[model samples]
Target chain A: MKDITEKPMQQWISKDNKAEKALKRVKQNTTARIGIGRSGARYKTDAFLRFWADQSAASDAVFTEVTPETIVNLGLFEIKTKCRSKFEMITRPDWGRIIEKDQQQILKEKCVKDPDVQIYFGDGLSSPSISANAEDMLQVLKLGLEHEGLSVGTPFFVRYCRVNTARTIGPLLNAKVVCVLIGERPGMQTDESMSAYIAYKPHPQMLESEYTVVSNISRHGIAPVEAAAHIVELILKISKAKKSGISL
Target chain B: MNNSEQAFISAGIDIGTTTTQVIFSKIRIKDTSGFGFIPKISITDKKIIYRSRIHLTPLTHENEIDALAVKELILNEYAKAGIAPSDIESGAVIITGESAEKRNAKAVTAAISEIAGNFVVAAAGGKLESVLAGKGSGAMTLSKKTGKRVANLDIGGGTTNICLFNNGKVEEAICVDIGGRLIRIDSDKISYSSAKIKECIKNLGLNIKEGQNIYNNNIVSDLETIASSMTSYLTYCIDPEMSLPKEWKDSPNTRLSNRPDIITISGGVADCIEKITSDSFAYGDIGILLGRKIKESTLTNTSFYQKSDETVNATVIGAGNFSFEISGSTIDYRNSTFPLKNVQIIDIEIDNTASTIKRKIEQFCSEYQNSTFALAAEGIKCPTFKQIEETAKLISSVFNFPEYQNKPVIIIIKEDMAKAFGQALRRKLDNNRQVICIDGIDCGIGDYIDIAKPVASGQAVPVVVKTLIF
Candidate 1:
């Protein structure tokens, strides 16, 4: 028993050297959390709404905070947003797919019976950076859409939703097109960000080729409003071409 | 090597969920006839001179008949060892898997009982049968060798059995419902289903139905799915909530560890040796294969035993060995046993006297549809006739109530379904009162009587109940 204890003790004391090496590696490749709440609840809802409102208002487009029920009547368009952490984003994909059952029932009652288009904005894993860059991007998007005379759908804010949820719910409500704005996974050096993913004929099992995406839409990266304008121009091109991804 | 030289052969049989195995040994009989008829004489010169030929019966769908085949195989092996059935000294049987729990398990035991009638039936008699059923020879051998408590976890293709031994004696054993074949795999990531699993087993050309609800003959994929699921369960089993033994927790190599002493894997999955090393080199199959060889020889000596070709014969061998051990009386193998007797059943009935009075109130609400008095009520702000009628149609469609499609109808119920319908209506109508289910008891007065005043007065919230009324 004494021999057994001594051998393990020697191994433990030597493990400090290994720990020091691990610490050095961690410092060289830093990963940070940007917009997540300390508590597990949806504490970042107000911040998300405020950011969405400012961005939409700056672009001359009215933004309304609607439940899953209200969104069905708003027709379809694209959504945009971001998140701050990788673990928070990956573990909760199902939470962002659809509204709760009770909310879904309410939407069936008050919203339009079924609309042609439905788009959503999700914060994915980098909400903080996406929110910061949204204002400038929306202005650019509005101008591009107007220049092409494309009739965009009503826009609104969706909290804690994912990009895929737009594809899933869009077809259920008979939406012809659905787009989502979500934040990309953040690396060590960069934090401020957002991205837009668009799809046509969206449904539960739509192919990846049915959509398009634009990443790094942020102040320190791609200018937010400018990226939004580029996205709108691409949307017009897709609508004229009647296709997306490899097909276009 | 002289004419007077005789041999005492001892054998062990293990009948597993997916396979059967047997093992045998022949020892020189000193100062006694090799036949088991005479009493044993203490002799230090006696020693095992030669081992009998190890044999196995192929598994088959006609497993009922396969037991006879196993007995014949055992007989042949005994002959090869230069001994007759009556001449063999001792043996043991360990039954396991679905066969042990079959409705005709007793009948099968009775049929095999005659073959080893001379020897004590260790597995068939008294309370020891169930206890010794799944205790493969591994645990038995370990117990005898270590003189300490040891447990054997027999992992088969479709099920896993855990048998424990203490102080060179059998204790308790249990079979967990999960197996290697049940684990699920979606590409590289392995996971388990929290939902019920339905699987089907096809033996030879005949499909044998097993599991919750048998659908198609796709046992291989189902087994893989189950095995993957066990990986997750193995993880959960180590949790403190599960109350696993402290030894299991303190060990650094739990489940996926490479420590050979901590755990051992045995069965069909163990054949994938590379996979075991990477995951946790904790599996072995030698004990079962050795058991199978002994059973085959026991059956060959008995004239009544027959053979089959569909399955890896292990159970029959186990059964044969078990019969020999009890009859030979070389060891007291009857400690663990369970008795079956005195079972009972019962039934119940209910009366329906209160339902007759509730029908009269429903009739009164129907008459108020076209009346001026009904329209004059406060909060009777019915939508334009078309909107009210359309709302009614939508409600009917949503609730699958096709009969009320073209009528200006109001539904009234006296049960819980009515309340659920009301809640559904409230949700669908956005708190509108186009549909409602009123609650009250009839006091045999006015046709439409309000037994209790409304709890809270508000606009009628449309509620849709989608339940079948009895």
Candidate 2:
């Protein structure tokens, strides 16, 4: 990768000063590609190169895998989905949402029964987001819930996971509320953005609106430590309302 | 729109030396944090809903402010606007120019503030009034729109308030005892004269006194001298350290870094002067003549004199607008600990050591002599859960000392970790003491912040940040 320049790169070589100044002001607030000077109705060399660089980074994030050392550092035991490879998980999304018959017995033996809140961490699309924010976010959230005197179940990690996996895992653990924190799809703006999907009671027949989601958890968006406090408060509201998602 | 997005009613009352006016406005607050994120609440829109008819400031026998009459006037205006006092959420009452010197000015301001309902602010200062007048006159917005430096001269009844705006922020402000109502003309004789006007007359060697008729020979020259005095001050022709006129010596000098590209005149005399022709004293004063004199005098440094959106009601409109700030949603607070007024924010270095934090707290306590203040730390260094916990422990150690015991601890952080850090501190400290922690407000060291109680439907609070230094 090549480093970009610190000074502003002006796009208008023909010299409309007012338009150039306006573009500069807009560029200060956003990272989207804009105002790149064109050469004969085509993007300039620098702009083309930068676009390719962002695309390559987004591609890399999708194929990456969470490391074993990271799971051990966060003190979480890992579980596998029915999908064996990244290719299978990407093409067959339904396979990633279910656990095998043998894995269900293991889940029940290791997890607490009838817990007030159960939390899960998974690498959905970008492995960097899980490795970057999950440990700190989990630590702060666990502390906050304990302060509120709520019973939190044993935390675990899942491999090749999809969002719908909560529907199968919730019933097996007998949890009243289940929250899944996973990486979001990578975009040119950021690759480490994360999302938290929470459901009151997970079942196969639950509608899409039955899940309440909080997304864009990153350093530039919502700081992971700050997001933890909001997550705990949201769980309390879900419990008191006896509902989640659009119903709450 | 979400349930937290609601509109609030605000009212602004300006009690000036020559006139009193009222304005009501509506402010819209909405959550913009988007889906699946912490709610970042902000005020997105403001509109003026009502503009009251301008009224004369009623005075008592001793020329003091009549508090009862003023209260009745406000009540009538609210009734005319079809609003109850309880409907007002936040606003300000500003006493400007000569009215600020009245013996009962404080009492009148307090009376209006109580009558205006909760969250209404009471303020009396020349510099703050100058800045507000500039904001209301559209000088601030003009600077932002045109990207040019703007200077506003608010020539009201008793004083000429000047404020310079660059990039939509107030750069400099100064007030001088030069205005349209300084000399009141009744029929063909001078009915009333201020002491400052007497000094100007003596400086020009004019044979004039109270009750004397101004002949045609000296009237134009006298008015020209008054107008030129104001122009010379704005153009920097008058030396502030040595040759500043005695009338302006009491007010601090204006400090401008660059010459303004546009000059705007607001307040009561602005409309009359921009037309440049008036025969009669319609307001029973020298306002018309003063306006004509000011029009004739030229400001050599400025390129253009732009028209403002407001004229006489500039201060009241500014007071109604631009008077509140909404806090971020994730603040740590209890319902009983709010509506804090005039709390000073003493900024400190973001040190992780507990001893350094203790020293700064002790130094602030000794300097302020046990006055209640909020500890405003800049963005935390390395904002992780462990780092935030360590900072919280450091704060608890400083506030739990013998000298600072039992005081409600107020902490303001610049980052979004207020809830995390606040909860950690609460768990570490004794349960007897109260804690109020807020975030997402980045204020300078000398600034003062006032926090109002949270709104009924939203958890976000309203904050007012002010810098009163000249």
Candidate 3:
């Protein structure tokens, strides 16, 4: 393995020079890597270094914890899945889908029962993603729901969570619709990408097709405020159709 | 609202010196984003549905445009096209070349654009007229296909507009008062000649006056001298001995470093030249003779002449298709006070200090009469949380100034950070004033923007950047 402290080779050779301008124009229109000139059929030093850096960022996003300030700023109480530790949470994904009995009792006592809409923030795989996007996303979601005269239930954050956590809480709080904003699996391109999974009348036996998802909610992807706006509209459409995902 | 395909009716009308024409088109806008992805709306298709027959521009006896007659002509064509004025959603109306110099030109153009329905109709100057004609004549595409520079010479009734295209994009342009109808011939009688034409006649050492019944040989040779002078302007980038009009002298060439690869001719004169008719009295003027002389002129430059796809109707077709842009779907703005028109857009550089941002706003306040100005900037490149917060704080500080305390702050960023920046700005302002911040549309200083209300998706707004000042 290359030394983590050393920088990669950054030089690129070109005779035409105009190719550099054309490459810049192409690069501005897309996020995909293009025009990274090679050296003797090998990757350039900068390119190799950038690849490793992004890989480390993706892993760091998965291992880090959500900041306490973010939770407090959004006024969200904490909950945890049945998984005891981060190692066990990654090894046994099934445990992350189930809330413990004690946590279920806490949710039932605190959340508003039979609400029109319930919202959740989960640090699925990337804690930094939630901390980066959750504040603005939560505010917009609340404002949009309130503007349409729909009551939102008590919101909370879940640690070591999964998308199926919504399935567990929907029955406990008796929510008509459950929307969970969770961090997506980290990719080398971006680690802060988040996804919003929404289900109408979610239950334990609900198929994956019954849940609608809006992925790529981040600064590098869709702006969080715009994502919330889209989510509000999507939820309204799902409610009117009484369906989601493929059905809607 | 259904997230499906939506179509809007658009119109393009060109009122030039010699002819007036209109074209109606249908633009199909749809959400191109895939399932489970953020919405991305774009104009996927444009089809010309109706093309009006070319009509002679109505002129008054006093040498000005006949406004009522022009209005009636457009109305009659709309009736023939089987569409009401309300059918046109967006498009442009260009009063080009000599027609733009008429006494009631602005009013007539504005009225025609208003009559065409809810569309943008602004008069275009010579430079823009040349670019539009080149785009309409397919010279732009030809340059792109060959990967070479092409210069379009649109020779109309009163001026020859030249637009240079390098790799399918317009680089520079110039328009000179050299055209076919500058010398009017009425049944062998030299009935009238513009002052510019008389100067050319004197330079050619020909005894010609307004009332002389000149022979065809004398007029044809005189037309050849004038055509050679125009070609010399194209070749040398400078007219010798002020043979052509001197108005465009100060507007000199900066892009003629090397000879263009190809030169294409369009407009009415080009139509007559390509037809190659023997009769000199065609169209009751020396237009045919002038065209033939221009074609036969010996240009020493290496540029080769090529035929254009469109001749007389180039500007009209280009005005129809190339002026409107659909904004990115995910924009941030208030819906209640939209469909704004004629908003002056001022370009700003991203400032690092709060005082600089205030100074920029103050400079804009002193420069323009309108209280509301759209500030455009190349926003934060990465748009991280810290960058967004700093940008928002700077903008909110400018808005909080005493001069613009209660006014709405409008920001137009070139980057895709409009929503987040707007949200941050709102938090900073504490919802004190209205803020409309939209991105995904690139515009520069001195360009006016017309933003329509949000479409059915309720996320994006249709935008038209009006090049009114230039």
What TM-score does each model's chain B reach against the true chain B? Answer: 0.38, 0.87, 0.88
Please write out the lDDT profile of model 1 over residues B322-347, one tens digit for every residue: 22211110111011111111101000
| Cα-based TM-score, every candidate | 0.28, 0.89, 0.80
Off by over 4 Å in 1: A1-248, B1-7, B27-72, B79-81, B120-149, B166-171, B179-225, B231-262, B267-470
DockQ of 3: 0.29
On DockQ, the leading prediction is: 2
Q: Identify the candidate with maximal TM-score.
A: 2
Please report the TM-score between candidate 1 and the true structure: 0.28
Superposition-based RMSD of candidate 2 using all C-alpha atoms, in angstroms: 3.7
TM-score of 2: 0.89
* Residue A91, candidate 3: C-alpha displacement in angstroms: 6.0
lDDT of 2 by residue, B1-470 (tens): 14456788988999988899999999888887665667877777889999989999988853688889999999999999998988887878888899998888999988998889777788867777888899999999998777677888888998877788876777787777777788777777777878777776677576667676666557745655665665555445222333565544544555455567788889998877766454646776777766765666664223477777888988898788876667668777642466787677777665746677667667777897766788888766327888877778788888888877766788887777887777777777776678878887776566667787776354678876655543
**Which residue window of length 10 is worst by lDDT in model 3 chain A?**
A5-14
Native-to-model Cα distance after best TM-score fit, residue B40 in candidate 2, in Å: 2.9
True contacts kept of 3: 0.35
lDDT tens digits, residues A76-97, model 1?
Answer: 3323223223344356566556
- Which 10-residue window of candidate 3 chain B scores lowest in summed lDDT? B238-247
